[model samples]
Target: MNEAIERSNPEFPPKIINGCVWKLREKSPGMVNKPSRGVFQLLKYRN
Candidate 1:
């Protein structure tokens, strides 16, 4: 994950995911596991 992010944007900090609210799920593969609360969330990034 860090490698991909760095490849795309070298200036991107490694700490970006540190304080972020994220989850890992076995069924969803490489997706963020949190549920969307409303319509606005549907357009948000999933993986």
Candidate 2:
């Protein structure tokens, strides 16, 4: 789990360095901040 996530997005692991392996990419907020209407409600809160 650790190795897979690290290679996909190298900058990811450090953001949640203290977190566990179960945390999904979508569950990790702030990683992506693209504004939209359907999914990614957090985008509206950004900027």
Candidate 3:
């Protein structure tokens, strides 16, 4: 079975989306503070 399966990318590992979401929600607190939302928004929080 291992031989039949193509090798996965070495750079990135598998992750649980729900766990990641929970962590982000807990850490950041504010909904609009996420980095991917925008650089401008992140700067907005700084001041």
Predicted model with the maximum TM-score:
1
Candidate 2, 1-47: lDDT as tens digits: 45666788788755574265334335766564435432333454667
Candidate lDDT values, in order? 0.43, 0.51, 0.40
User: How do the residues 1-47 of candidate 3 rate in per-residue lDDT, one tens digit apiece?
Assistant: 12112244334333443344436635666643445532213334654
What TM-score goes with each of the models? 0.33, 0.31, 0.27
User: Which residue runs does candidate 2 get wrong by more than 4 Å?
Assistant: 14-18, 22-47
Off by over 4 Å in 3: 1-10, 16-19, 32-47
Poorest 10 consecutive residues by lDDT, candidate 3? 1-10
User: What TM-score does model 3 achieve against the real structure?
Assistant: 0.27
TM-score of 2: 0.31
- For model 3 the local lDDT of residue 46 reads 54
Candidate 1 C-alpha lDDT tens digits along 1-47: 44555688778676774223232333344543435431112223744
Q: Poorest 10 consecutive residues of model 2 by lDDT?
A: 32-41
Clashes by residue pair, model 2 = none
Highest lDDT: which candidate? Answer: 2
- Model with the higher lDDT, candidate 2 or 3: 2
